[model samples]
Target: MFKTIKNDLPASIVVFFVALPLCLGIALASGAPLFSGLIAGIVGGIVVASISGSSIGVSGPAAGLAAIVLAAIVTLGGLENGGFEKFLVAVVLGGIIQILLGLARAGIIAYFFPSSVIKGMLTGIGIIIILKQIPYFFGMDKNPTGDFSFLQVEWDNLISGLLNSLNALLSGNISVGATVVGIIALGILLLWSNVLAKKAKIFQLIQGPLVAVVVGIIFFLVTQGGSLGLLKEQLVSVPVPDSFDSFKGQFSFPDFSAIGDKDVWVIAFTIAIVASLETLLCVEATDKLDPDKNVTPTNRELIAQGTGNIISGMIGGLPITQVIVRSSANIQSGGKSKMSAIIHGFFLLISVILIPTLLNKIPLSVLAAVLFIVGFKLAKPSTFANMYKLGWKQFVPFMATVLPMAITGDLLLGIGLGLAVGIFVILLKSFQNSHFLHKEGEDVNDGKVKMTLAEEVTFFNKGAILKELDNLPENSSLELDVSKTRYLDNDIIEILEDFAHKAKERNINITLVSERGTVENPPSYIEFFKLRPKAS
Candidate 1:
């Protein structure tokens, strides 16, 4: 663990920068107190990281959960009572349910997802990140900076925001200094991995996000002295607690009184299911990005996320999950172990406590610069190339998942659509060639003993094959071939073996040649035949 810490610390800084805005942005979007986001971030990093089996995955408040949180608040809080505390109860219960799921080994659900679907999901998220950050990058902070779905914002509002921005520029309402800083930050970020960093060896020692943040602060300082059109309102400002005591007062406990409400349970189950699925997805993606090929145990990750959410809810934080943004940043920053994740959580805790004022001084545009880079990596050209190379079977699912996710507001819905398409293709292929044909008079004495495979040969194929064998005349030789079969599902293998035994009792000889394997019904019979491996 200590060795893991050495590699994780630097990566932790990168993840920390990536996570900060997301935490606040998700909270803002959810109509929850900003501190709730911070609390979730802290717990997700520290509590979850400490227990999670993942080496590179970073957990925190996710934008995906914002709608659920908002809806739960409205439904459980009774519009008048600010059911915010009741929502917190749901979060706690959700955590408990997640822990149960992990124990039940439900983490394998991640494996059920096709690789194309996962890639599409990542790409969809990348596009969303870029779009959402545009407003922040341009200094238009009126809208929440975390919405991934374009449908969430009306066309009129989008057009108006763009037109108003141009008007602001013409009317001299835009902060030229902030804009300059934002542009500079983006320039530095773009060049951080390029010639500038290579030429200036000193730049190699600093991360792009860290440098961008510092430059943003310096620009703010320079402009603050003269009030040169750059105002405090123009910068990113999280809620600053007046004192340590005031900060502690932000913590809210779950209202156990709401446990009796069926609505609360419904919200709780939703949270648990959504949060766990999201976390598992993040874990799988982070592992793919990890250079070491370290595989995180999904079950353990669920348990860790559950534990963190429980703690976060008890302390008045939003629901937590393994977040891909921070995890990807951690990987790109050379994170090697869970230590980076743990350190990032610690950073979130310490930053809010000791440097709240400085955090406020940092500009949103700078964070946008950081996120832009992260988004670019997720949707990089190489990603597209790799998916294409995987062939149409893979690419189809990838595009199906990506396009729908980009258009639809729901991640699961997009994936469900893609999976449906993939299954349909599979079924079509099965139906087209779902048969095993043996030549009439080649391997057998007569054409009467020829064998043909079932249209759908599952484990249940055993019964059908056995019944066919039972109908065969005694002392007859049969040629059973499954060369053109589309599916040689597992159950069929067992059935074939059972038929082999029955064939011996009837003094019947059988030859089995399939896409899977060759089986001579008589153990003493010897003939080589081609077979195909089972599907993964």
Candidate 2:
């Protein structure tokens, strides 16, 4: 652990800077106290990283869960009267549920989600992050950080909404200081990540987002109290405790009594299901990104995340998950082992304790600028075009997942819709290729009609095959072949037997072909099916 410090220590500094604003930003989004995000980040980095089998995964409060967290808070009736406390109860219970799932080895459930659906999920969240951050980009402070619903947050359409934001800026509704700092911050982030960071070791060691925040602080100090300076509301407001003794008082606890509430259990189950799924998916993606190509044990990852969430909720923190953005940053910044993640957590703890006042000066716009880049990277135009080229089978599901999530602001709904579309495509293909009809000896009406059954003919194909048998040409002879079939369904066998009985109605002669000998007048399908050595 100590040996990798050369690589891991510097990488941890970069990750620490990256995690700082995100922790605040995600908490800001979740409608929770800013310090809670820091707590989750610290616990994720320190507790989760220590236990997780993943070498490079960095856990933290996820932007993706902001919606769930917000909804849970609202459902419990806000922070008053043990509401937020009840939500913490859910988080704790959710952690236990995750532990149970890990014990049951349910991590394999991630494999069941289609690739297109998962990509669509990442892309949709990216788009959401972009949309949610736009208000901050222009220094518009009316909207909350986590709120992404177009129906609630902005105008009827995206263009009009952006135009409205521009109109607001023109009308002096913007914070000039924040806007200026944000632009420079975004410029630094792009310049460092795209150009200098890759070209020079020094730039790589010192991350872009860190520079952006520091520059934002200097900008705030230089411009504070001026005519165009940022308002107090426009900056980060991590509650500054008067003393270390008082700081301890800010931590919240769960209302164990709420464990009996039905709604509490519902939210707990939702958090467990969603958080665990997101973790598993992120584990798969992080493994693919690992330079050493190390395979993380998925079940163990669940146990670690479960433990992290339990600890985070016990004190005061938003729910946690394996965050892809931080994990990706860790890998890109030369993180080799879990020690980098562990160290970053310590940084989060130290920074909050020692410099809450200094950290509070960070302009929300600077963080918004940082997130805009993260958003664009995830939802680039190339992603959509690549999915398009994969053809409709893949593309349709991808779009189905993206469009609804983008519009409706619901992640689970978007995935559910995508899965429905994916299943539909599968069923359509099955319906199309259930059976095959071929022309053989001569004319279409007068000659042999050779019908071949697919290898596995299920009930879905019974209708198409039945239709073909009904339309058989009068005075025609037919050869129905099942030789290629491996497992014929009872439905198809019944259809064939019924067709054999009615062939004489059309003056049609029939011969049934299979691995068994040919039958001129076919016997009961059950008897014929029974003749196969292994068929039952």
Q: Pick the candidate with the highest lDDT.
A: 2
Give the per-residue lDDT digits (tens) of candidate 1, residues 409-514: 4677777887777666556545433344333543335534767664455332333354465567777787776655555543245345445665676677777666
- CA lDDT of each candidate? 0.74, 0.78
What RMSD does each model have against the real structure? 11.5, 15.1
In TM-score terms, candidate 2 sits at 0.73
Q: How many collisions per candidate?
A: 4, 1
**Span of 10 residues, lowest total lDDT, candidate 1:** 522-531
For model 1 the TM-score comes to 0.77
User: How well is each residue in 235-337 modelled by candidate 2, as lDDT tens digits?
Assistant: 7766688997889988898889888999999999999999998798778667655666655777898999999999999998889999877887788678999
